[model samples]
Target: MADQLLLKVRTDFVERVTKPVISGLLDDLLDQKVLQLDEVDEVQDRYTVRADKARCLIDTVRLKGTKASQIFIDSLKKRDGTLAEQLGLVAQQGPPGDQLPPPEPSVGIQGQQQWIQQCSLSEYQRIRDKEGDQLPHKKDPLHPRTAESCLSLSSQIYPIHLPRETRTRRALIICNIEFEHLSWRKGAEADVGGMTELLEGLGYVVDIHCNLTSQGMAVVMKDFADRKEHCTSDSTFLVFMSHGVRAGLCGIESGDETTDILSLDTIYETFNNKNCRALLGKPKVVIIQSCRGGKVGSVLMSDSKDPAVPAPIATDSTPAGLEDDAMFEVHLESDFATLHSSTPDTASWRHPKKGSVFIQRLIEQFRNHACNSDLQEIFRKIQYSFGQFPRQLPSQERSTMLRKFYLFPGH
Candidate 1:
């Protein structure tokens, strides 16, 4: 009989929910001593169980459309009221069938005391108006508890909170246009203007640095990383535009010598958790607009007069730690992303008059979608835009990000 009851309930559960869910439920019921296996028939689906003393096996097995149609309704209500209510298996109170109890007439405070007593203190307070009259008790959509719950859930799901315009929004734009020996980049300065304008419009306090040597670049980056703004800000952007090779961006080394290359590894290490604790756990975006190599790409010209431009330059895990042989420490690192102008060993396109193809497309796409789309999606669109042309394809690298990062430009 117990086996028949278990088999019936299991069948109903599988039919209504899923086989996997029913399997879990069966295990839980067995573990909780609510049901015990009695016998297993030759058929895989047939099972027998011994129910608890309080639970009736006969009522628990019935699945017909009679008065006791729902099996385990009482047991489910006793085990998990919320789950029973969600599954619509809770037994109706008052009269049976589809008939519900008639609504009670409006009553005074004396008659409503029992219902008011069941409410939380804060909820009860909200029931009264400012004039102290007992107002109709309506649920508050913006209650403090509700807001806190939502925030808590969001934080758990998306650990990093992308900074808003109201917070400290800072961007560093380093454009090296003038080289002593090499021909000066024609449109490098224009790129700075466009980038700065776009960033500022998005509420960033843009700092532009022009024609810096390798040492100067390092100093500026270090200083910026240590800024108090980064400590308080939700996110930061570092944009570097100059000549470059596969190793890194080229800084001026005594005029035209490209010997002074600021290595990409060094840049990453500088902003890492250990060095730049101020920006820890916040999104750090690095945008580079420099050539990575000498390989140039072919362009398919359209009917439009715009000339096909040459490639312009471009531009963690958690672990446990022990201290003092007695204490254990844990550290987590995340939320860093880099957007490169082109793939490794490839030249990035630049327009001598307009700007680098990457930066131009970036600014346009950001303006169009920053308010609605995430940073990754916007970058993907920029890459798509370059697909029509030649040579310049953007690439992105990201560390562990708990949630999506969005600029929310113009917000």
Candidate 2:
């Protein structure tokens, strides 16, 4: 046998292996009628017998858009159930009601009332701190919690109606060019393009940037802050594929101590801001792909149950030691660490490539799992897929910690 085996293949070859497996899974789902729904609640929560049909419906809409929603609704016309009852009620109501009451004057912009009242409370605190509580309360638009005044629930569910023209999606892709000096595995551009394509397929307008310098990254983040301030999108996502060390991701300026890399806090704060509330209470997705610090084992098992039999003890010259099917695991574990925080005398290496290993898998999962599900569903798919194909990273590989996030599930 050849000493050096070519277990690792290019993107084309990898796709070839994955396509059949995914197609079979999809076909199985379709055969089981995972796309049909008898009731409206079944559309969201799903039914046991009709789960396959529901899943199929989700898959179809993910590929074909809301036309699937209409088709599913049409399928439910025959049955006279709750949804049918509701539709009949609407039909009885007709286009115009009997001398309908005049429309209530628009509360000058939605949510403004609540915002102003909250601001007034803060102001009151400042006034009490600067002066004594003896200051007379002034009559204002916002009422104080005195015996005479109280806050009323606004009829509007949301402050602003997101215009149909405006695209409401927030996504991020952060890449670290580990060996920029060498120009080998630069995955940022591919990461951005693949992710953008996936998002757009799911009805979103995506923004992309490539090869950002450290300072450039900061500037771009500031723009995101401004978007959040203006409520550009209801949901947010952040993807980072970059060269990183044990501490965090590396910067373009590797040698300089000041520009080694930016910490996760700096990046998190930009979107997590309380004032720039565009993504508040919405799902924020973050994907990190880098080498964590750990020793590379000679062999990686592929869920094997058999005990160690008499197999040939391979040497380092050959690529036959670890049996892990995953290709992202490199033999050099600390190389990524050195890239982020280079030795004082050494130079940095940043290379460009088709895409990062983690990123490629993420895109694949998004394409497969994010069909009709919300962002959190997408994350669930991501976590499941990664569990199936574990990466060889340091023991301290970056783990996901999404704070309070709300998606289509309402939480």
Candidate 3:
């Protein structure tokens, strides 16, 4: 049931929003001797922080191999003054340990309180806002939660679809939101809703979701791996919208340390044939809206500056790729097709209303072209529209990766 899905989403929310604080607090306390070895051992003995810890590590993660150091710090700090002194000596002689000294006694105590409040407050508010006070655990959207699912940090990206008919292929739209909660992101909302409208009209069974976690996102793609099970036809479309750092998508959860975003590859690779079913050998289309680089080195427009409205550009339709044999070569046939509004080389684009520039352009074209031509033609048309969409002063760039996919007539 959809409510069960919502319950799963709630689990994700806890993992995303609250688990980090608990995990970090555990780390900070254990390192600072605030939490004794026995306490940690007891917690580990009962519940060793699996999902919660994994989520924290996934977000706070750095290069690699640092987690072990963190755990060592926790265990070492759990020991008495003698061990700390010995560890201090080891650190002085070798590498400094990764854990930060526990905050000043007063500060650590107060900070712990603050962390608990901050960690739980916003999520509770969000659940209350969505589910209401009386009916908190409304599992199905059809029936509101009787009590907001009390689970911490759990949330979902709702992707809805209607069963397909004979003429149309199945389509999936994935929208990722890096910033605000999924409910609050107007840009993501409109774009996903718009895609649903356009694709449904185009004779495709469209599946859509907004603001998914890395794991959740991967699961969505994996669901698409089976072409026969999910879709009646061979062709399909997939979309991704999110706040992204270069090469990655932001998970709703915070990092164990740095809070840097996770890579899109974390989710995208799920659709790879070795992993998924329905998506194998199908035309997989992906659209992304996120910054690709850090070095734009330019100031953003001031409050008084008039926004440059996006104007549609005019261009004749061209073939998907340039090479002659490339027409429908489907170069890595099982691979996916991607069209990113911002090059992995640039930062991000703007959308005060309907969503990211890439999604905005996608909706515009899908609305205009989905019904008339094949998915290949629709993509090319959308590509042209995006190339024409206006950007802020340091105009954002756009590009696509076909990865050996062909959406229309085969050569």
TM-score of each: 0.53, 0.41, 0.43
Give the number of the best model, judged by TM-score: 1
Q: How do the residues 246-336 of candidate 1 rate in per-residue lDDT, one tens digit apiece? A: 6677775533334677878667767878888988877778898887664433441111101232333333233455441222111333566
Instruction: State the C-alpha lDDT per candidate.
Output: 0.56, 0.37, 0.43
Which predicted model would earn the best lDDT?
1
Superior candidate under TM-score, 2 versus 3: 3
Each candidate structure's count of clashing pairs? 19, 35, 45
Q: Which stretches of candidate 3 lie over 4 Å from their true place?
A: 1-164, 178-186, 226-228, 254-262, 294-335, 371-377, 386-411
Report the CA-based lDDT of candidate 2 relative to the real structure.
0.37
Candidate 3 deviates by what RMSD? 20.3
Model 1: what TM-score? 0.53
Residue lDDT tens for model 3, 1-411: 111112122233333334434555456656655456775553344333454343223222211123433443444334333433443412323334423443222111122322111223454344434433333443676765433244332222111233322344667766553333322233454565555544443445555544556666666666655546444455456666555555466555423343435555554555555555555555556656555443332243111101221222233455665562543334323445566655434555544454555565666655444323434455667666655534421222221232222221110
